[model samples]
Target: MSLALDLAPSASVEVRNVDLAYTRKARGTAPLSRFAVQADGAALASVPDEMEVRSSHLVRFSPTGKPATLQTYSVETLRKVEISTSGDTFIGSTDDDLYVFKDNKKSRFLSDRRANYTDIALSESGSRFGTVFCDMLAAHHTVALGDQTGRTLWTKDLPFAASAVAVSRDGSVIAVGGEDGDLWLLDNARNTVLKHRQEAAMEAVAVAGTNRVVFASGGGAGVINAEGQLLWFTEIVGETVALGTDSVARTVAVLARTDTNAGRLILLSGENGLPVWEIDYEDSRPTGLSVSANGEFVGVSLRDGTVCVYKLFYGDRLAAADGEAVLAEARAARSGDGSLLQAVALLQARLGSVPSDFRACDLLKETLTDAKEQALALSANAEEIGDFLSA
Candidate 1:
């Protein structure tokens, strides 16, 4: 795939304190794959019982990669739940009302009414939050910034349904994107910092720690800094349904559904929006994504009621079957064979990926060695094809 960046990339940008969940070892000739679908996750402090798990639609992770408890907040069936960045304040929305749990008190912010809240976001300090509200009685939509006490600080009517909203770490800037394909950056005083539009509906939007904002949709994803400059934009291959952003590491994790309901998860660098790592899924499309622990681990929710977590960096546990299958197929190909051309193409694709594993490099070396062995063993009646190619 071809990718273009609006600004020139820096010399180098590495994620801070990246960790690998899996590991690979060279015990023998058969090395393991670099990627894998882990069934288990980090240690759990406490979680909802069976009944609560069934009703819950979203999952959150703490800074230590453990499941975050709502603390004193009572949990049950909830449409959405959001906690303040400081981890003290908790707010959740049900089918009819909104609740805020703080200071050992749970208060109802919104009474039982005909209004519906689709999305809610909290600032880092828990001092304020941003939300998108839709009125069921009529076709009216509004986005507002509210204090911890449920007081509206600022509000605006949107041309489209505001599907996603985010507040910067400092609570001075708010980023809101709507289904009308518009993304706007607003100050705390309701001043527009940046205005952007795309061909597809904007579903996933976030405000980075550097005061930069990111927005993604079926059309593509892009980053705009606080100065209203487009840092980078790239057209993705599939419909980006959901995404996760890491403010500390400055990374964006996109979950896209490709052909045949297959899922493609790509992690992009926040500096230039370039892909840092990627993996694919089969049959099930992931609908939810969460990045935690400074981008060390990524957790995704699939349509098949399954949740998988993966580490961002290199490790020792070898379980990526698809990658191993491709390499094994390439190893079986010899010179002058029809599959030789196809094998080279596959190997190049693997190598093209930004970070490659040691097994892939070793396979390339073995392929050339196997080709030479086959060529030397040619029959007397067989015509020589010349020297074996090596790089």
Candidate 2:
């Protein structure tokens, strides 16, 4: 099962889906076999019930080369879809309206709200779903399966005109970005409002981790905690964009326009409004930005039909410095010098590395080794600095 591309009469195909569909042509006889080319793309063992040829065009594809409404044929159309890290497929749907083919059956994770559903997002573990409904007005809901014969978990009324919805990897947090320029974070387990903002109209939103939310709205991007504290904010120039978040480390990656030219990926620290890293997409705008469950890599899908992957590492500069100080203390202790502790104190105060670096083993040893001398020196120097600090 490899991806097959249509040969434009006689042209080399650069990239195409390794599926059982392709366009081909021949001289006088009927067109050549469209499935002649051996496949080489995202593997698909069996076609799903709903197969839309055009992007965003939902269509149910029959094994015999027919397309229908996804919800029409109950047996085949309702298919559960799951994407594995190694490119394996899983089948299962939640309790909502949009059903998926999973476990050889049709399942749904959304409510059958008569309102038009605009967006849906599945949790990283496929245990929950977040959906947006636009009726006379718009609102959002996050649903999870309960531990009963057939029970479901739903959040309280989230009456925001949501543009997008995202759930955390652990399914602890659900975020909805409103088209009306408001963002709401919900605690799915407890059905509580963790945080919300009405400043920017959200264009895109993604759960960074368990407690962090990343949203792109108005002309800027910002991150907020489960408690709704504004961690950081920055500007990006794009009308339509995508966001990815890392909850554990509280980081965000924004795929937005760069210099009014092209789209780029900017990784920001959720703690401070500072950029950790960025990647350029040249003249292309991103359709999606996905961060892996492990938070090690991010995948950006561009409008030009290209997907790029980037590796990311969280940098704890203050923590590293603190670790160095602890090591110095340990070394001092091993050397039987008592002055090491005083040296550490002075270093920590001067460098402001006190609470951040708690794992200062070697530093502790060094501090212990010089403890006696340091204590004497401190006693003398304290008189000068103590009054200065006190004053």
Q: How well is each residue in 1-391 modelled by candidate 2, as lDDT tens digits?
A: 1111211112111111012222111111111010101112111112222354211212222223433323222332322232222221122232234554333344443344444555556554445555565553433433332211112475355555667776665556767777677776666664557657656677877776555666777677776665676665676655646666543544456777664547776665455544545556677555555555545555554445444445443332443344455566545644567444555565455334322222342354445556667678889898989999999
Cα-based lDDT at residue 294, candidate 1: 55
Total backbone collisions, model 2: 69
- The reply for model 2, stretches above 4 Å from the true place, is 1-97, 108-112, 136-152, 258-261, 313-391
> Residue-wise lDDT of candidate 1 within 1-391, one digit each (tens)?
2244455334244432234453211111110001111123331111234444433212233334444444433555555556554445656677566776566566766454456787777665668777778888538888778778766687788777777877765677777888877888888888788787766778778777545677886567877765656667767778876666765436677778886678787777665665656678887666556565355667665555455566665333223465677687776653444465567667766655524444665677776676566667775225343333321
- Output the worst ten-in-a-row residue range by lDDT, candidate 2: 29-38
Candidates in order have lDDT scores of: 0.60, 0.47
Measured with C-alpha atoms, the lDDT of residue 39 in candidate 2 is 16
Candidate 2's TM-score: 0.53
Name the TM-score of candidate 1. Answer: 0.67
Candidate 1 minimal-lDDT segment of 10 residues? 27-36
